[model samples]
Target: MNSLKGHPKGLYLIFATSTAERFSYYGMRAIFILFLTQALLFDKELATSIYGSYTGLVYLTPLIGGYIADKYWGIRRSIRWGAVMMGLGQFLLFLSASMLHTPGWAHGLMYGGLTLLILGNGCFKPTVSSLVGQLYTPGDKRIDSAYTIFYMGVNVGAFIAPLACGYFGETGNPDDFKWGFLLAAVVILLTIVIFETQKSKYLLSPDGKQLGVLPDARQQALSAEQAKSASAGEQSSRKWRNLGILAALALVFGTLFYLWLGNDWVSVGIFTACLVFPISILLDSSLTKIERERIFVIYIIAFFVIFFWAAYEQAGASLTLFAAEQTDRVIWGWEMPASWIQSFNPLFVVLLAYIMPAFWAFLNKRNREPSSPAKQAIGLLLLSLGYLFICFGVKDVQAGTKVNLMWLTGLYFIHTMGEIALSPIGLSMVNKLTPLRFASLMMGLWYLSMATANKFAGMLGGLYPEAGKEKILLGFRIETMYDFFMIFVIMSGIAALILFLLSKKLRQMMHGVE
Candidate 1:
């Protein structure tokens, strides 16, 4: 029945589920930093630090969530639990905002809300992502298109969130923030309802079996046998070696970050795990030579992804602040809320999502489609240009001068195109490259890169030029908007060049998958 159609009905259901979940997430995120500064009464630097750590940990827990899904709960159960936790998290934020008069309870509730969010996202992100790929058979070209569709749902939520949340939360008064948080909590309930009611009927394989069921009994038995094959002494030695390696990596990275950023343990932990987990995947004894090479390709592409996200995620922090304090928002005698500016990227994403996949398809028809890594390299290049565009807009502007909103608008437009190229394509690539048994875990590892980047983004956001605060990075002093934006230009430019050079080698490593 489904053979003639381009995609299954389930894909649309996944789209709905993802859309609701993202609305909940991005809605809360739209004003979180503002909530920190205005409601919680923290400074910009501290708010960005907390913002970075919150976003970073939100991605990091996916590793644990993915592990749990693979080993115990399965994706369906994990997602349900995750949705509930996130809903509760948003509700707590509402309570926190409602109690703004009591600073201590407000602060306590905010942290508690953020904790639930982090744990819940750990469960939700990777599982939903992995599920999209599972909808297709191996070698099906539609996988990329499906993920882009799913990605559009993600952006749909992002596009609307800031408008709704910002209007309610980011009004001139701090007291209004509770309404935005409450809106997010309500949206999450929709996600639970959509998934739970529809999943049994629509979330099925081609042969009519249910998907995301518990691991096969035979597969568990096979794993048991594999464990039995390893001698106790050998297992002990391997465990110690892995621990030693992890310890050494943590020490080296922790010390370096401490020197560079001064005792930001969150960045140190996230960054250290970024390197350690990818390497640990290589340490698995079951991998064949071809599998190992393909895995390396994922690692290589993921390493470059760190730079893309670090710059791109500035939307939620530095860019939002720029919109608030430095951009001329007055249009037709109305000033837009700063948090609304965060919606631009997602708005562009929704517009461009179809165009990008079709563009790739057009290239594929002519046998001219770029390799996944090559496309990602192009994305990095576009990211660099976006920052460069903004750099020009900000150049030589006086301190206290607000530039046109068009400047930030243009940057979001270009960056959205870059994101279209990189983010969903990268998800499609990970699913293509991963072995079936390791799908969830590998997806978790992919997100681990973003965790590191987000933490780093927070550190960079702290460097946003404040009048009294002098922040120096790598011996260069940042004293203006130009200086701050240039960091992304240089960082993403170099990464693009290097990744472009390595793309051919990496494509070959994929062993004909692309």
Candidate 2:
């Protein structure tokens, strides 16, 4: 079956699966920091560090998962097993929360749960997203629109999970946290059931074969041919040797950073890998001049994206803490759950996702559309503006005095607009620019930016000022909320300006893909 717009039924099936999975992931995230600080009694800095590590590892594993899916297990198997691991991970979290009175047991359980979630996310995230790209053919104009709708589905899950899970978990009782974790587990199980049952019936390629299955003999032969073509040069062997050396260097740097920096090892490792892997690829003698330039463009845009996401992802850490501690949550004589604020960005995404595609269509029809790199620059600008909004909004408010909830709400709205401008488009850009032979690998590399961003977000979140405490970062004093928010304003604003200046050149380097 096809929609009136001619998108296949498989799109909706994948949408449903992704929506439920996101619900599980985001629901857990909604309460994770609160659970740590309130239930386990961890400090704000420690909890945020752990939160960053967990989130960063979640993106990091996709590199491994995408490879396994492409080479051996296929998408369906990887997703299934991944779902199981995630379900178990959530269950462990529930158990951890349930044992909150036993601090030692709960702490052990919490680490165990986080490890599993990281492993599971590595398997599920990239493969499912790649599956969405598979649903559309090359040069399909609807691809962006399809991703927009798919992104809405993601927000639908994100929008609801916080409200539902937060209500259950944050009712002023430490023990209540288990309810949220349990809810996450149940939704993930539901996702697996829906995906396994319906995939055979509705999920199919454009040629009518079932989707997510392992490659057959003929497909394997073709992949081998493509690989051969990609490596057909005298320097192929040397490039492989260089890649190994880079990998070793990455590992060594990662270990040293871990030993020196405490909990930030994952971020350091991912940043190292992101830097090394691209240089190794650029050194590949088989790549054409065009391919090399395109790859360079990807790397350039990816670097700017790191700044964007580091600012944007504060929602899960510093922003969440801000809502809980500083922002006024009372409305019309009712005190709202702090986690309810988690719904705001997704709610805005749901509202704006519909508008953006149409807005872009209007622009494209008139030949007035900005290129992907240009739009991303706009996104970083909006993110900077969002933080600046908060900076000014809270400038008059004293510490320990709650401000209007609208301040946070307005910020999320602006941030969501920035997200719409950047996130979905980045996915489309990667799929369009990558060569077929390196598609899965390139997608993993794209996610590496996210991994670095998330860890960086955590590091920033760790800087959040505690009550009556002055925090200093990079020789600057963060003596007030205004100062904290101003950090992002300066960082994202500068990055956006630089990206805007480079957009024209990056667009040219894309070789007219758009």
Candidate 3:
């Protein structure tokens, strides 16, 4: 399992820290919906809406984190402080849960806890990613494989969190939601402490300056290999001209493409921001022609992946609640825990993650592997199919008796296959598309794709009726219980078709980067 080639032990250090971090984050998140709506008697739909906003903002604020990490605090300092903040936030959450009966004080602390988690996650998320990049050198192919390994660390935490936290929140003593919160807080605090004590053993002593803090002595010598650099004044002006051109494009979408007004606004905003760096290259940027083209191709693929995340992220806010209050959970003479259902996703991810790499190697040997876009398209199609499974399964279940756990379990398995196809590999594609100069910015934008997708997923979930349920789909009348799942299935299918049409163009732009 160990792939060794002078990879500093720090990679494993990061993997361990991430595992702990995921356990803490997911443990809390997986149970929060159930605790809020079921235990606290908040309306399910309102709790879902709020959850969506909370999760969306959690991701959206990273733009600020990236700016500060790049310009002021540096990655290590920002990351450490973020850990401290998140730890404190988790602890506050525990106190809030304790005071749930205290009315006003409870509400204040609840908001306060959420604010800290968002701010802390924003600071920690981007910098930790940047630190991973710092662990590698230019032209190192191992970066892709290393990230796959890191993502597994994420799944490991995701897989275990539900079981651990659900036990505290839902099982044994039912009023122990506070116990779960306390446990989650303690775990996060432990992660922060563990990470701090071994900083030197993990990351190279961060130079507290900029993105260039390579611990490897060889890296310092090779820093001269930078592809391009410009004065801040020149860079700023070039970005402006780039904005002017995109503004024209935006006007076209706003005025002429009226049928898709909402989409037009979003697509234009995305396309406009995307156009900036390449346009900067065309203007103040200094690079060989090959570099610009490569970056352009990467941008093309990035726009394509946004749809994938929009479909995949529905699992947390919407789907989790759907399973809880709607779906039948009766199995083996017991009602299944709603929070426990979420573990099925990462459970599938963990089981099948190792299979894909082997399958890819086999495909690579035979030249039978699908292209990146094709693989991603397949993922969407399968995810769509998974949703369809749940829709059909529960279309006839009794009002409160519960849907079988096996359906959720099976659907997660299919969705995990889709994730393996798209998500794990998408990161590698991003690094390939990004040129050295705009690397961090491009990565930041890449995450914005996820941020938008998560919010949209939340909104989609809200469309479901958590009360007075019934439904119609594909011109056939069905239970309202199954309608939202059907909609998601249809949406993912449409996304797949669109991506399929554009796959050739995306591949062409990739210029063999995949």
Each model's C-alpha lDDT? 0.90, 0.86, 0.68
> Which one is best on lDDT?
1
lDDT for each residue of candidate 2 in 323-346, tens digit (9 for 90 to 100): 999888888899999898999999
The true-versus-predicted C-alpha distance at residue 435 of model 1, in Å, is 0.6
How do the residues 1-514 of candidate 3 rate in per-residue lDDT, one tens digit apiece? 2224546556676777777778878888887777677656677666765676667667655656765666566666777787778878877777777776786776678778888988887777766765665666655766766777777888888888888888887773436777777777777776677667776655652233233243222222313433336566866887787778766765664455345425534333433344343344444345456666666655555555666666677677767876776667777678777788888888887788778878887998999877777877888888898888877777866666566677878788888998888776776666666654444445565666666666556556566564464434446654465766777788888888888787787777666666
Give the clashing pairs for model 3.
328-402, 328-403, 470-480, 471-479, 471-480
> In terms of TM-score, which candidate is stronger, 1 or 3?
1
Best by TM-score: 1
Give the per-residue lDDT digits (tens) of candidate 1, residues 159-259. Answer: 99999999999998999999999999999999999999999888877677787777422233346567677898998888889888878877887788778
* Cα-lDDT of candidate 2: 0.86
In model 3, what lDDT does residue 148 have? 70
- Cα RMSD to native, each candidate? 2.1, 2.5, 5.1
> How big is the positional error of residue 315 in model 1, measured in Å on the Cα after superposition?
0.1
Choose 2 or 3, whichever is better by lDDT. Answer: 2
How many pairs of residues collide in model 1?
A: 0
